[model samples]
Target: MDNTTTEDTSDTEEEILVYAEFADSVNIEKYNSMHILGIDTKTPIVQMNETFFTGTYENPLGTYMFFENDTSPQSTDPVFDRIPEKNVKYVCKTRKLLKVEHGYITPKDGSGQSTQNQAQQAQEDAIKMVSFKTVQEALDKFKQEWCTNESSSTDNNINNLKES
Candidate 1:
């Protein structure tokens, strides 16, 4: 029956996909990307095939070489020694390679960034502790005391009143 055939075909396709995934997992350790190998630093990334490049991989020399296990995410490591040359390869300039030499790419949060965040939090805490008796009184006092500069007119008036 047609229904029976359809179910069998669907089950077969599912099994094929699972088998392919399992096969890829087995070879995962051997696979590495041209980018993770630091090939992008020295060489440009390109796709040569006019056909759809569903999955692609290359060595340092621009050769078309597919890894046995390419299911893993791209690598973060920064070096590669082998690349193959391909006929359809195209080349273009790339961004400056980030110097990852001195452990520049790291997991540590920046001390300065965190320091500023803490300082801001402390400032907010200090502001919350201020218990002004009244807004108008606070504002009047703030205006009189905010400027450290001496007022010559006020000084002269104070002297006149003192002499009187």
Candidate 2:
């Protein structure tokens, strides 16, 4: 009773060149969009893609191209020359957990009693760790902190607070 054809599966694996924005550094707001060999290659497409959108979805910072396993002479495009021959995987497909830690001192310890000080210190040491199954989940957590709507400032402020 299977109606699905092999074409469906083929489409998923078919390799096509993809141009995407990648994060230049840890800052999420910074991105370098470029054209690269697609997921079909042995490149780390997952990691590259994650880096592209790691921080904010604001604007592109620059442009860069990466091609793995290419030994030929450099192309006229300067971006193409940036590609490294070894360890050029652009994406990571591994299922790894992303962890974020948060900690805060208790405000009730304003009097600064010895016991309260100890408790406050302990509370600060007690970090809350959140793990995400995917990079998108992690990105979403950051996106949730900001107002995405341009028309409604009130709604933006109300929902901008960090979720408990």
Candidate 3:
């Protein structure tokens, strides 16, 4: 008889998390545009029902977007700045985006739990755990890298066409 235990070793890396808070729907549109234009690639893992947005960052320890709100949760770092006071609505940590059933976003996991239950769980986990400085930093870098060059070339071509 042999009484031995084998340990499981895997090479899976942990997913990075970032938190962002937008003041309104316009800011959310800007964020979506930046994402579509390839300016921001962190791909939101979860978005709270309200303004909070959370995603994965390539370098979590380095520069990343950070949200600040007096009524929100506090992290270990002192890099965040408090802004207008407002109670947080929800915090979602799941990787998949919420399904849109009809006109409203639904949390239909399709597993075994009820949609309401899943949504409640996501909301409960929506507090800001990690801090980032500014989401604009990454967008600015992306614009400088891709948008500027492309726009300049496009303008040059348009001017040349007009001259011809």
Candidate 4:
């Protein structure tokens, strides 16, 4: 009588469970090791209610995977400003431009506010500008902004050409 237990190790890469949200949709996916985590390599394609979305740097597929000891891009040492802790949803910060040409910020208390506050406020405003629940909504907003702004100037140019 032979009592031998054989273990099968067929695949090298281990599958991990991940919750990813983007394009106004959420997914519980089994992450494959072949995934390239970065801005360039498009991955984690999603289709929700007939609309499709691909992971990009600007609109990334967020997950809970991040190195706790990873340093900030600005600095290589000192453990960075701080690594995002586990279970805490980290927001991708959209910073205001360091300088805006011919731009002026209204002062509070008759004095300029802190740069950090200014930058944070700018980001909040930008977030509100394009906040949408779905892709169609975003597209509609873009169309309205794009089409309406150019039409007035374009019509004037055409009228001038006809008059000339």
- The positional error of residue 90 in candidate 4, measured at the CA in angstroms, is 19
What are the per-residue Cα lDDT tens digits for candidate 3 across 1-164? 99999889879886544334332343344344232111145444343234333333332333443344446555555667554356453433433222111122456565566767889899999994644478666544544666456878865664565469
Worst 10 residues of 4 by lDDT: 95-104
lDDT (Cα, 0-100) at 29 in candidate 2? 42
Index of the highest-TM-score prediction:
1
* Over 4 Å off, model 1: 1-104, 107-129, 149-164
- lDDT of each prediction vs. the true structure? 0.39, 0.44, 0.46, 0.46
Query: Candidate 3: misplaced stretches above 4 Å?
Result: 8-13, 18-62, 72-164
**Over the full model, what C-alpha lDDT does candidate 2 score relative to the true structure?**
0.44
lDDT of 1: 0.39
Any residue pairs clashing in model 3, and if so which?
65-132, 66-132, 91-126
Higher-ranked by lDDT: 1 or 2: 2
The number of clashing residue pairs in each candidate reads 11, 15, 3, 0
Candidate 3 lDDT score at position 38: 19
1-164: candidate 1 lDDT, tens digit per residue: 35543343454332110001121223334534313232223422322222111222222322322234333334355376333332232333322222222112345589889999999988888854456799777755654664335676765654565469
Pairwise lDDT winner, candidates 2 and 3: 3
Candidate 4: misplaced stretches above 4 Å?
Answer: 1-9, 25-42, 48-50, 57-164
Question: Candidate 4 versus the native: TM-score?
Answer: 0.19
